[model samples]
Target: MSDFRSQLQEKLGLSSVDYHSNLSKEALFQEALTYDKGRIREGGPDDEHKAYQTRLGVQGPLVFYTDPSCTGRPVKDTFAAAWPEFEDKIWWKPDFQKYDPEAYLGLRKRVVEHLNAKNARLYVQEVYCGVDPEYAIPVRFVGEYASHALFTHNMFPKDVEGVRDEDEKRWTILNVPSFHCEPERDGSKSERAVILDFKDKVVLICGRADYCGVNKKSMFTVFNYLLPEQQELSMHCSANVGKQNDCAILFGLSGTGKTTLSADPNRRLIGDDEHAWTKDGVFNLEDGCYAKLIDLNKEAEPVIAAALSMPGTLIENVPALPGKPLEETDPQDLDLTDRSITENTRFSYPLSANPNVMPGARGPHPQTIVLLTADAFGVLPPVSILTRREVMYHFVSGFTSKLAGTEVGITEPVAAFSACFGAPFMAHFPSVYAKLLAEKMEAHHTRCILLNTGWSGGPYGTGKRISIKHTRALLDAALRGDFDEGNVEYEKHPIFGLLMPKSCEGVPSEILNPRNTWEDKDAYDRQALKLKEMFHENFAKKGFGAFGIEDVMA
Candidate 1:
C-alpha cells in the first residue's frame, strides 16, 4: 500500500488497512463513506456546547455549507449499482486542486452570511469519508448561522469496481460537517459550532470547488433520486413539455435542435434535457435547463441568448479574452476559454421554483416518444412513426452523424448507440431500461416518432445543414398535430432505417432516399456497406447477433 492509502486506512479504520494504504484520493473518499451510521455518529465531536439558542419566533431560513472536498460518494455509488460498468467514470473533474480550501471556505462564509441576513434558517454540515472502512467521521453544525467551514481533501484513480445484480445494491454513506456562526449585535463572540438539521427533510450537496467532473453523470443521479417510485420515466434526447393540451418531446443528441427547438416562446417548458413519466404525468428532474455553450449567436437561439445570466443558473467552461488584461466585467464573456467545455452548459430555473409548472409534480408516463437524429448525410426523411420493435431497434442503434468538431471524425454519418439516448446516466443495464420503456409505451399507447433535424441535400459542409429555424418550424407544426393530419409515406431502407418524406413541407424530395443524397451512387453504396459492417461488428461484440439485431442490420 502507498502512503496515501495507509493514511486513509488509519483514518477510516479499515480491516484491510494495509491493502488500502496505497489507494488513490478518490478511492479513499469512496471507502470512508461506507461506514455504518452508528460508528459515524459516535465518533464526531459535539456541537451542543457552542450551539446558539434562537428565539421561538425568529424567521431564519435553513442554510447548509457543504464540505468542498466531501465527494458525494453516496450518489456515485447508487449510479454504480445501476450500471457497474461506469463506476470508475463517475464524479466531478473540475480544476478544484489549484485553489486553496481555506480561501474557498472563506468565500462560502460570506455567501452564508449574506443569505442569513435575509432571515433564512441557517445550519452547516461537515462531510468526511473514511480512507478505510474502520474510521468514518460525520459532523453536523446547528446554530443561528455558521460563517466558516472546513473539510478534508483526498483524490483517487478512476475505475469501475464491480457489477450489480439488483437495484437494491445502490447505497452510500452521507457525512457532512459544517461550521455555523451568527452575526453579533454587540460584537461579542458570535456563537460558532457544527450544526446538524436532520429533520429538515432536505439533502444539501455542497462543494467549494468550481466544478466536479461528473456533470452529466451527476445530473443523472439527481434524476434517479427525483424519479417517482412506481412509474418508470427514463431519459431520452428530447425537448421541453409545454403547457396547454399540446405535448411534444423533441429528441436529438447534443448540438441538434433538442435545446434550441424546445426553448420556444409559444410553449412552456417541462424540461430541456431529462424528464420522468409516471402514471400521473411527466415531471422534470433538474431545477433548471442545461444548454450547450457553443458558437452561440443571439439571432440563432434567442431564448438562450436572453437567459445567459439569470440567477441560480450556472455557466460552464467557455473561452476567455485573447489579449485583453483581466478586468471586472460580465461573467458571461469569461466562459470563453474555460476547459470544462464537454459539460459547458446553462441550467434554467428549477421546476420547484416555477409555480406555473406542475404542482406537487411527479414523474409522467410518456405520451409521445420522439427519437431525434441529425443525419449529416441528409438522407433521412424529416419524420416517421415507429413500431415497438422499431423503437427497440433504433433505441439500440442510436444512429446519428457527429456534427463537425463536436467529435473528432464527425463529418460522415457515424453509427453511435446510446441506450435510451443516455447510456452514461442510466441506473440499470441497457436492456433493463429498454424493457421498461417498451412495456410502458405499450401500456400507455405512447407514440414514438423519428425526426431528422440534419441536412436534406448533401452531407454536412457540402449541402446546407438543415436551417435551425426551419427545423423549429417543422417541430412547431408537428406539436400542433399538423403532421398526423397528412398522409405521410415512409420507405424502409436497409441500413439507414425508415425514411419519412411526405409530412414535412420545406425539406427536399430527393434527399428522402440515401441513394439520392450522394453524388456518386457506388461510393455511397460502399460507405453504406462499411457503416452496416461497423454496426454488425459492434452488435456481435455486445451479444446482439444471437438476438437477431445483427441479422436485421445485415
Candidate 2:
C-alpha cells in the first residue's frame, strides 16, 4: 500500500481494507455484491437467478434503504473551506457555503474519529474524471460502503493511461455515510455535510442521506471550479455524434430532456450529464451516465431502458412490487411510478451499457448547440432557431419549469432560472462560461436551437406535455441539417425574438407555432406575456447588462 492510503486507513481506524484500485468492471461487480451493499435484482422474467431473493451482501439480495429525512442533496449542510487564495475566486452562496479553515480541520478530526469508531472494512477505488488524459484529474473514492465505490468505478474513467498506481497528484474523497456532525462544534448546518478543500485537493464528509449522487456531484463541483481556469467550459449537458461525425450538445436543468433526447440510437452518445468543451472539441467528464428512472418507459427510452437489464447497472431507491417475492423481483417488475422512496430514482452504469457511445467518451467539435427547456407555461414553441445574441440570452437565462412534487411542496409548474443551466455546479462567474460558449460557437459556426420538451397546449394544469415522439422528430430534423436546408421559412416570436420554423418534416405544420396549437389564442398571448415578464425579471436579477444582449428580450 502507498503511504497516503496507509495514512488514511490508519487515520480512520480501518480494521480491514480492500484496495480495489483500477479493478476491472467484472471484479468490482463481484466485490460489490460480496460486500452486501446492494442487490443484483434480475432484469428479465426468465433470466438466471430466479431464486435469488432481494437480500444484500451477506444478508441476501435486498435493497439498501436510507432514512426518509435525507433523500435529496443536503445543500445547506454542504460547505467549501475558505482558503485565502480561493476566497475571491469562489462564487459564495447557499450551495457553496464557506467554512472556516481551522474549523474545517476540527470537523475532519471528528469525522476521522467517527470512522475509527466503526472499526469496519473500507473499500478504496481510484478513477479519473476527464477522458482526455492531459486534463484528467486522478480521483480516489474511499468509503465504507462497497456499492458506492463500485458506483465510483462505473461513473468515472478507469485505466487512465498516464496515471500510475501510486501517483500522489490526485483528489481523494473520504465518504462515510454513518458519520455525523454537531452543528455547534463542527460548523455545520446539519448532521450531513459535504465539505471541499481545494488547497489540499480533498473532499471530506458524511452523508447518511445515502443518495449516492452526492459522491459523484461533489467531484463534479470540483471540476466545475477548476476547468474554467484552463479555458475549458464545464457544462451540465449531454453530447452525441452522427454518422458523418456531426456532433451536438444539449444543455438543460432537471425535468428537461437532456438525457432522454441525447440517448439517440441513430447517433453515437458521447456523454450524458456533464462535459467540458475545449479547443480540441468536447470530452466527457464522466465515463458513465447517471439517468433518472422516474416513469421510465421501454418504448419511449429504448436505449436507457435496454441498459437497465445489463449487469453492473446500479439502481437506487426503486421500489419492488408489493407482495412479490424478492427473488422474483425483476428490474422490469419494479414500480417506476412509485416515488415513495424518491422521484430521483437513478440508474448508474458505464458507457459500455450503450452500444452507440464514443470511445473514451471524446468527440469532435459540435455542429449544433441545443438548449433544452421544459416550459410548463406552454408559451415557448416546440422548436426555434437562435441567433448568437439569442443564444447568449437563453444560455444565461437557462429557463425551465419545475414539475410539481419534484421537490417538497412544489405542486405546480414553477418557473426556474439557473444560469448556464447549472448554477449550483458553476464555480466561476456566469460570464466566464457564457463568453466561452459564444466564442466556441462563433468559431465553429455551430447552429443553436431552443427546444421545449415541456407542455404545449396550455400551462401544466391545463395542457399535456409535448410528446416525446414529436420532440425526437424535431431533434432529428435539426441534426440532419433539415433546419438549414433553405426550404423552411422562419418567423420571429414577438416576445422572445426566437426564429420559429414555419414547417418541419415529421411534425404538424400547425404545432410549429405554439400560438396556433392553443384553442384559446388570447389566453396563450396572456401566458406568453407573463412568461416574458419572468424572463425579463430573471435577466435583470442576473445582471446580464454586461452581456449587452439585453435587447433580445425586447
Error at 156, model 1, angstroms? 27
Clashing residue pairs in candidate 2, if any? 36-57, 54-61, 54-62, 55-60, 55-61, 55-62, 56-60, 56-62
Error of 1 at 56 (Å): 36
Pick the lDDT winner. Answer: 2
Candidate whose TM-score is highest: 2
* Predicted candidate 1 versus true structure: per-residue lDDT over 1-554, tens digit per residue: 12432332233222221122223323332332232011111234433221111111112101111222222222221212212333333322111011122332343344344433444332222222111111111222222212111111111101112323211222111122232333242111222211111112112223221122233334344344334223465565443455554555655666556766665666556666665555555654334444455556657655555555332233333333455322232444544334332334332222333333433223345566778878766556566667787776667666677754545644555556554566545543445555566777899767777777777556676766766656665666556555552456656775656545454566555554656767877766676567667656766655644444333545
Q: In model 2, which regions exceed 4 Å deviation?
A: 1-63, 117-120, 163-168, 324-328, 405-412, 485-487, 546-551
Residue runs of model 1 more than 4 Å from their true location after superposition:
1-216, 222-231, 242-244, 319-327, 332-365, 403-414, 480-486, 494-499, 544-554
When summed lDDT is taken over every stretch of 10 residues in candidate 2, the lowest stretch is 44-53
Model 2 lDDT on a 0 to 1 scale: 0.78
- Show how many residue pairs clash in every candidate, following the order shown: 72, 8
Query: Candidate 1: minimum summed lDDT over ten consecutive residues — where?
Result: 149-158
User: How much lDDT does each candidate structure score?
Assistant: 0.42, 0.78
